[model samples]
Target: MRLRQLLLAITLVFTVAISPIQTDAILAEDMAIIVEVEGDPNKWKAYIEDYHPFVEVIHVYDTLLNALALKGKSKDLYDIDKEDFVRTIHPAQKYEVPNAAHSPSPIKPPKRNVNTPYTGKGVKVGVIDTGMDYSHPDLKRNYKGGYDVVDFDDQPMETLPTEGMPTLHGTHVSGIIAANGEMKGVAPNADLYAYRALGPGGVGSSVGIVAALEKAVEDGMDIINLSLGNSVNSPDWPTSIAVNKAIEMGVAVVIANGNAGPDNWTVASPATSVKALSVGASITEIKIPYLTIPLEDRKLPLQMLVGSPEWNFSKPYQLVNGGLGKEALPDVQGKIVIFKRGEIPFSEKVQVAEKAGAVGVIIYNNEEGVFQGGLTETTSIPVAAMTKEDGEWLLQKGKEKWAYTSYQLVKDKLAPFSSKGPVVANWDIKPEIIAPGVEIASTVPGGYQELQGTSMASPYVAGVLALIKEAHPDWGPNKLKAAVLSTAKPFKNETGSLYQPIEQGMGAIQTEKSINPEILIYESRLTFGKINEGVKEKKVDIVVENRSEETKKFRFDYPHHESGVVWDIPQTFYVKPKEKKHITVGLRVNSRKLEKGLHQGWLTLYNGNDEVYLPYLFVNETADYPKIDGVELTLSPFEQDKFKYSMYLPDGAEQLTIDLYEPESLRYVKTIVEDEEVKPGMHEGIINRGEFVENSYLVFVKIRNGKTYDSFVTEFQNFPLQP
Candidate 1:
């Protein structure tokens, strides 16, 4: 009965596409062979019952037998199978997986919250993937409802016939978003919904995705996480359109930037859609290993994991050592394989050790702390890494047969595989931010596992976005995107090379930076105008205000402008004697936009030359013009000698506020101003000065927002007797 319904469903899908089911040629590439399996239900069942010889079987293209035909075992069957089965069916096509070609795992970027709470507690995040393992402890409590789009079943419950379904890929992906603590997701407080868009084989159709997305939209999801994408590009693809619709309806869509990278790089379809938040990958530190030795050898440290706590190597789990390239490597089939870091892809070395039957793999760094590398999907063994000194000690001790065993894996810091980018193609600035993608400990089916990939990076983003959305319910993708992108510090690569905003797009997404609630910035993102070559000028008004305490002393320096042009903004501005103020910079362009090209440069603001650049992109035109609103300020006096101060300024407010406890002793006190509401061109009184004080105090002030507005201390000496 189930087979009859499945066949009927297949027929309907075939009829819907109009074109004969011309299976994509790429689908054939991964399978070993194509066999003629008669469409008749009896024959298909008989084959499965009597001769189950294939390694991996996929009922692709609705009834096509995608089976692996091994060389020796299937030879006799091929001869007889062709005569009996060939006439009953017929060879359709041939395909095979590329040599060593496999899908890449997108890295989960390391999240950087601006140090505010933004958990999407009441919001729902829908994950469209294979069925989630709802029974898993970490996910069970959060499971709202999920539909197996593949089977048209409403839930991943007992009713669905999952006879030959694929593994739990969807479950793992869902865990990355909604898994409870122990394997906590970024937005642990958010609600979860799932849609099984993929089958057991981690494959799904375009129509299924559309169906799932449409359902999610109807269900009113705040964010939709799509980990699947089409291998081949098609502009009119249904999934792309569905995702775009979801975005139009105020849903933030997070899609995988396709795991096909390191070459021929392009984010897949839905990810490529303008509305989608295409996420890439980053490497992060994960689980740690413990190495035990006698107390006397404490001075000779094993390996140190960065940002990870020290492990008591003297705990349970027996330790043993073996020499490098040794035939029998520490007999680690069920234990952690402790190996020194050296030449070759870490995956290759780990695989060899695993082939020697090692269970868990541990490679210590070649330096002092931890070293980083990527693991292959084919290797299922849990791998933990350490530092170079640890590897050396292990090598030295292996000569002396020191027992070493690691109990758990601890994350030290961000990993190296996490690809950094200022998006190359769109040049729209990609990799909006970095997150904990590599070796992250997230919930897995049945238990916890440390997984890595850009796949992991994206959900961290989705989870964080959920939190931001939770806090600012009014923020749209544009504001959220801008807040995330604009606030990221211009990060430098490992080699100290300045990372362009185009490559590490918008810099790494810093969660800590996104939830500050208040941001001081230039009202306009891109200053626009047209100016003729030679002595042309445009004055862009910049708002300056203080988000923190202390009067601001501001100046713009180190102008990085394109050739054939000279530019200038206000060289200097001030907030107040001891409070934030608003100011503007005047810009003069000496030349016009030449030859219809973009002229780009950086504007660095100096609070004593700790320079940070504000990126500018200008299109070449006949002329250019730039303008900004002037600053607004207001002050109220609480007494004849004391006043409460406040101001309203733009995001790029040139203002700072400072607090002083003592009229004279201003150096040691940790003084700060809390959230103050001041708009451009206005100020209000906030501070109060009372009675009499014996001593004087000093206070320090810095730009809490780090953008346009900043400040310094204004000396308040001993107070005189009130008149």
Candidate 2:
């Protein structure tokens, strides 16, 4: 389904649609918001009835954290915010499944060779997501009961049958944790409880998620795997704060780092919660050996790209160019048809070739680099993509009587889409660890299929944590997290360039090493907050607890390439058995010489054959952005044809611009304000919309200063201005 339809479905599930208001008077916009009201529940209910009678309360929390999910008009929110009893009012954010892909055996437990066989036998893992297909062959045995927060029913799997169904997402996540049929999950024997927080399109509001989390805790789950999140990077965001509370209550929360990657400061909220074990995606490399295509006089080995349908043919076929379409194709009957990329979709081209009786289809890139492509619909023929150069070579050598060519799985590496971090608000190195996520084959709704993204990676870790929890039932979430972080195997990309700590964290999971270690670090990472030009040094204490039977001697080393910062570590140290030792690590920064953004390095502790790594991250505060604060936008309360906005701009704001856009199509409508000098403190303006088109528009307020830009968008619906 399209995003619009999906959003509509979510809206229908939450609130009933209302007709547009018919007067010059402003209408209230319906929205999902979290309200933290002070005083007793009875008083709050009285206040809601007395003033905000139109509000619909969703969930009420009365424990350590008191919050309520209320569906009300936007104006009611403003009135509620003004009341003294309201602590904070925030719009509930929506989260979706980050889309993953396949190797399992290589990263499985047997390959890691753990000392004890751990199948997560008794662990209760709560998959707080879209809902699971409990009856799926692989998940049935381990399926325990769960609740559906969306439908307010007990059966979480009651999902609407549609394209891009949410059931597949949750099922795939569950399979990654405990599927034990055709494929094996990280913890095949772990018990699973499905919580259908998200509906049809894998779209769910923070309100539903929080309720689901509460249900998980109440269900006595040992681990909660949240393979869903939104791009709210703030640590104190309601959902994120709740996640921390869950951790405080003794549940190990594992969340996806998100797939909004290849960019910095994109790690989503909840995952940004310091207590949650955030996971990033990594690609499992499958090496295909050179295929020997037998020529009349010689057997030449050609490295060819593997095709989908992923089948091996018994004999070789003649090669032909299928051109851009079927009409341009030569008789490709029982032949391997080569097609150039462009003009049409990759799948369509393959389908056309398949109709032309081609035994296999090869799509070559229009540009450089070999791409991995697939057919949208299943075809009897095999298909694959190759580089433009390879296609050209094959075309030129068509005269050669080619016979057949063959391929193997070699190694794996990190996926490029895995989000990078040093999380926006707090420069903490995220995605604490990486796992198999690229094209991962896991259980879908009914059977099995491959899915990809950090969604897959999160469960991989959650499954691994299940094992860790089973082996060390007494360990707290922190120790379990540290075990995973410290034991992760460092990795480099295909180019041999080492992935930054922010991108891959401590690296891929080493499940075997994570099970038991002689020494345990109190924290997986450290942050040296805001280093300014005048700050000379910062010191932090790292506590090491030796869990071994014998005393251990350790040597420490810091990153050699890190300059402008000096790391002071003890050359040698000793920790008594079963005792904790605190070591002070000092960082002297030459702030004047250091680069502006976030800088990071790792400190390694070596004890004989074992090594533990602690990552340190710090931001240079000398370089800062123009601060935009207290931004507020309101449609005219009286005139109904005007937009009023106010904001506080601190520091040098070179220019400020306000543009109007049609939210549906995201098309630029007109500029309300442009290229104006914005000064500090409260600034307000009125945009008269008497001349603009009478359609709903999104107003964007943007401020630019030097190289920094800050902007905010608000919706404005203009019902044909009253005659």
Candidate 3:
């Protein structure tokens, strides 16, 4: 009897131990989804009501793409997915604000002059973002009408400030377009419509954005600005498709290029829409005074860029050199420490100094240019960077009498956080234009606040587009896009090298030149796909249209690079009045001599005093790196009941290997597949959860294509355990 009782107790304990995991799996329902249904909308609504009452229909699109946004339990999703009329269903993805900086004077178009008639007077622009503060002095005058997709209301202005800073992002974006108070917007007189798709904390789903777009079109908005996007860079994504449709309906759309910067293939979704204007961030040359050190009769100004300028300290402090160690130095305590940039990461060096009781840290560059660095942990002290020259000068001065120093701003440059792109799969140059997005002052909930990101840059272009639309009310979206892109000023880094076309597109928008341009190009930029090593040359044509009434003579000029990439263009050409001419530009690249990366250059067309720029870019292809695509990884349940992964291999792949590892410890777990030959097509595999002991693991897929090898790594966590 006792033995039987013990066995029963063991069974009960086992069931108790696994119940939480099982419950968690059951509770993990699909709350957000987009569904496409066929036939009548009323029938679909009735079907949803009868079969899936728990599911809430958020949006219904009857025109263009037949779709509906529904939130419900996972089982209902499965049932709906199996319905005959249901075309496609996927989770409503989340998109974020890429975030912005300054105003109109940077681009010379609207000119901030009372006499300039193009102030976006008659155009209506729809801003789909966090709700706008309709009461703000600058935005109130231009507030037209909008809808709140989140709350399903007509009043789109933020209503819940007690929750947080309401309407922060939308207000800032609206201010950039039509703010007419203490700060002037790019187009002060444009009509503004606020679509509150994003909620508190600037978070919203793709369904809400789609609803906003549909409503914006229905309201007869001339242009729509989406300063938000996700990191998915496929043109076929739902948001991208919706953006294309909006363009098809004659409304121009502008989206942020995302803030996932300094890396390629980081341009966000919808921004990846070929028809939309993707704007990147650029820094303006606005100087902010930091410090002034007393030196005899004259004060020496020490201007530097602070990593976290929000953390400030003003009292004068002593200086010491805190070498790359946490070891105590008596002089460093209660003083500012100067460190050289080497031997360790900048954040680590600052951390070591902070541990040694340093009040602040100044890291000097090992190279020619100045940089901004930070500590991983938030410190009460200030930290900044100086150029190699400045650092050496400061070190020399430190040896003599104590030197006092303060901070000040220097010339504006590109924000380091601005996302770079040519976009993966297909190399499409993104960030069609750059605008001032660093430390820009714009409208906020209560007053003006300084924020920075590609988000700020996008609205700047939108405002500029409003002006262009006002000036040329009859121009199509493509013509407006071409005018802005062709007239932008190319930007070169401080080192005097032109930024890659993928980085800056056609460069900064030249509003003055874009408006009333003598000529307009059909395409914004030309993209020459991967140039194989043995391929000698390729050709493409750009059509130039003469808008002026008189015959015009033009001179073609292009900058040459040492990358073995050359462009052949006629030095001079002529176009008759109101005529179009195709200019064939030949691209020649010696791939054998060139490095395997994106190569770019500009071809400038000059018509007397007016000039337009076009950018050309190509990726030099080589077998040194394996090419892989269409990668998908998923886990069933929560703790690992099953694992499924699929990916496509290029033609040359000889072997493929898949391995699992413990990411935190970097410990090898198991090899699911090894030394397996893979053909150039969709390959998929599944594994049971029993094979993996840990709840979290990093899956690495390595491919050997010809003589080259490349690997892709992704992480899976909380997979369900097998019974």
Candidate 4:
């Protein structure tokens, strides 16, 4: 009886120990994740591995991001996450290249403005993207040594066909910056360093990007140009923070704002990083097609569909309405067809128009405002898009009205695809300035190709900065940024409304005016963020540095007084040569009297013949921004049992909870994160599968920033443990 009782006790102990973990629990096979830790990395790795046997440390990043890239069994990762030494867990996010043509030269290359244009001589500019064709004649002279984080090698060349998709992006971008042989770059003499973080097919991961930044900073690059970015728009995203840190280290960081534009808040990081020189795409001095009512003096600008032949019309053509462009029209032959955008593919519409023997195709947006579109396949004839209002007016004018084509040739027009922003948390204007990106001709691999995107535009700015750096070697990143922002040529949109601080970002770069700046405008943009009704007065200071060797008098050209806003302009001030003066600008806003939308205008400061315009803007009440962003869930690659989840709180949240539900049945599952206080920035942890039921789950992240509550939803399949 004693022996049997002892055996029963042992059995019970074993059962209790294993009960918390279900055998049939849903688990990850093997997954990659990043863990932030504070103490000694080596000791922490050992401690983590000793406690969680399945965890594997892939790489340790000590420079830019003090974190570890780890792979492990899902269940074990959760156990490791529970330890106090561990901090935030990040999903190794996958990133793809932001997809780029003649971009007219945004600025006349510096040569025309000055006798000896600064070609980035001796300046090291790093290109962090897919590897480049370093051997390309245009780039070879400027190409220097670099690291390949993807392959963990010293050879930072474009991926070979034997490995994956060959890339010419890095080459094109490099050529745009410092190409010296066949075609001239912005800075033909600037030294180029390549960081091949992205691999085949122009796809990579967050860890890779972080690693690239680390390497670039370690290499002591004078200016780092990241022509790549992810869709996350948060200012505190890991890479964005890294960029901010990089700038603090005295290296100028320039990043592509993203290609998902003409909408506000579409800008992506690390362009969202506060100090980075975030660039936007603009057009060069080239004429694009538009439609006119010859005698009416009325014109409808057309945004040519990407992948369609350029619209070239020497004379007017007959017009007909082809409803939706879904069906072929009987009498559309020998005429221009106008189709409503909907239902059918744009290429299909063009094909239909072609079958009807139409001379050209024009697609009018069914919704309000203009839209950018593309054809799946190249069309034989030209096609373009217009606003819904234009469509209605065109249909009202009747088919008998001939559509005469003309060119809206202008320099520095904002590209429809270049992303815009007021960063989520900071509400700072992004793409601080624009450069030409449309149909920009630059070096590819063996030769050259005309590609377009903020990607192409980025190198232009990089080159410009290189030249400026050559001219002003003593300038820091902030000064360099200020030089460009204060001098860029601000312009109005096609609608005659001044581009908002978010949309145009102080306008396009003017090489001649910016290359030799005499004064640096600190915090070049005057932003009064989101003001509450209680906040009647706000003040931001701008430091004026007199770089020129003479004392200069500064005066403010007062903005047109509006009833709602009262300006506190400082009286005339003077700064001695080589001295810095801080001027405080204040605004008293009456919320009740202000309009409902974004209020923005320019304030001009003049010193002698030199002038600097500061763009100021603010939102009256609640700003239009995403409160919750950068939500990610990563499944383990080694085992199937557990997963790591991460989320970013733009502003510290008073209460936060993640509720899980059955995806198909709408059944409430469990709350993983209870109403807990979370601070600003990234928060991540591993979760045990046993906490959830066996069903596909829909996740809802509920957050409260003060009294305001917001929720974001996502879904994933759930796996149950085996009995």
Instruction: Name the regions of candidate 3 deviating beyond 4 angstroms.
Output: 1-32, 38-43, 71-79, 87-94, 98-115, 149-167, 205-211, 232-237, 263-265, 288-409, 558-568, 622-657, 663-667, 672-691, 714-716, 719-723
Q: Please provide, for model 2 over 271-330, each residue's C-alpha lDDT reduced to its tens digit, 9 standing for 90 to 100.
A: 888788899988776444233345533232222221145446657678777776536565
Reference-based lDDT, residue 163, model 4: 88
lDDT of 4 by residue, 1-723 (tens): 011111111112101222223322423335455567777767787776677667887667677766665666555666666677667433455566732211222222222122455666888899999877888876788888898877666899987668866666787788888888757888889899999988876777666788888889888899999888887888777688888998999999888888878778889878889999889988877677767775666778887765556688888898888898766688677798889999887878889889889989889988776776655444678888888998788877745978877886777578887898888766787878888888677776556665668888888888888988998898889888888887887767788766777777878888767778777778878888776674389899989888789899999999888988999988699999899889999999988887655677788888777666688878787665677777776444223355556666777588888888887888887888765678777776667756666556788889987778999887665555555
lDDT (Cα, 0-100) at 281 in candidate 3 = 88
TM-scores for all predictions: 0.48, 0.72, 0.76, 0.77
Root-mean-square deviation of each candidate, in angstroms? 27.1, 7.9, 8.9, 8.9
| Candidate 1: stretches off by over 4 Å | 1-118, 156-165, 230-241, 260-265, 284-427, 520-723
If both were scored by TM-score, which would come out higher, candidate 1 or candidate 4?
4
lDDT of each: 0.48, 0.69, 0.70, 0.75
- Give per-residue CA lDDT, model 1, range 1-723, as digits (tens): 011111111222101121112222221222222233345534553464456444233222221121222212222333334334432221011111111102222334323333556556887989887667787777788888866655555775311235543345455566667567545567766788888766644555554566567678777888888866653232223455567767877888887655444322233455645556766654444444455555425332232221122334443333334334334454455544666666555556666667777555566765454333444234655555655666566556544444554454433233333333222122222344445555455554545444455566677778877877887788766555555544555556556664543234434566776665234343222243444355555555545434445555668775655555656556776665424344444555545334653344456766544443565444444211111111111111112233233322222234445555554443355444545433333233434434214334444443344343454444443333333
Q: Flag regions of model 4 displaced more than 4 Å.
A: 1-60, 67-90, 100-115, 290-309, 313-407, 495-497, 595-597, 637-645, 649-723
Candidate 3 lDDT over 1-723, as tens digits, reads 011111111112101233345536544544555556777655787788788777777667665457666666654555666577777422245665622111122222222323456899999999999889888877888899899876667888764657653447788888888887666788999999999988865777666788788889888899899988875656556688889999999999999888767666667677988899999988786544333334545433332332234435656666787655445556467777878878776656767777778877777878765443333333456666666887766666664345455444545456666777776545678888898877666786667765667888998899888999999999878888988877888788879877878789888987788877878877658887778777578877888888889999988876756667677879999999999899887888888888887776677778898766677778888422225554654443332354455554534258888888998998898888775677654566666656767667787878886677788787765433446
- Report lDDT (Cα) of residue 45, candidate 2: 64
Model 4's alpha-carbon lDDT is 0.75
Which candidate number maximizes TM-score? 4
Model 2 residue runs over 4 Å out of place are 1-59, 63-88, 98-115, 162-166, 180-183, 287-410, 495-497, 561-563, 621-657, 661-701, 705-723
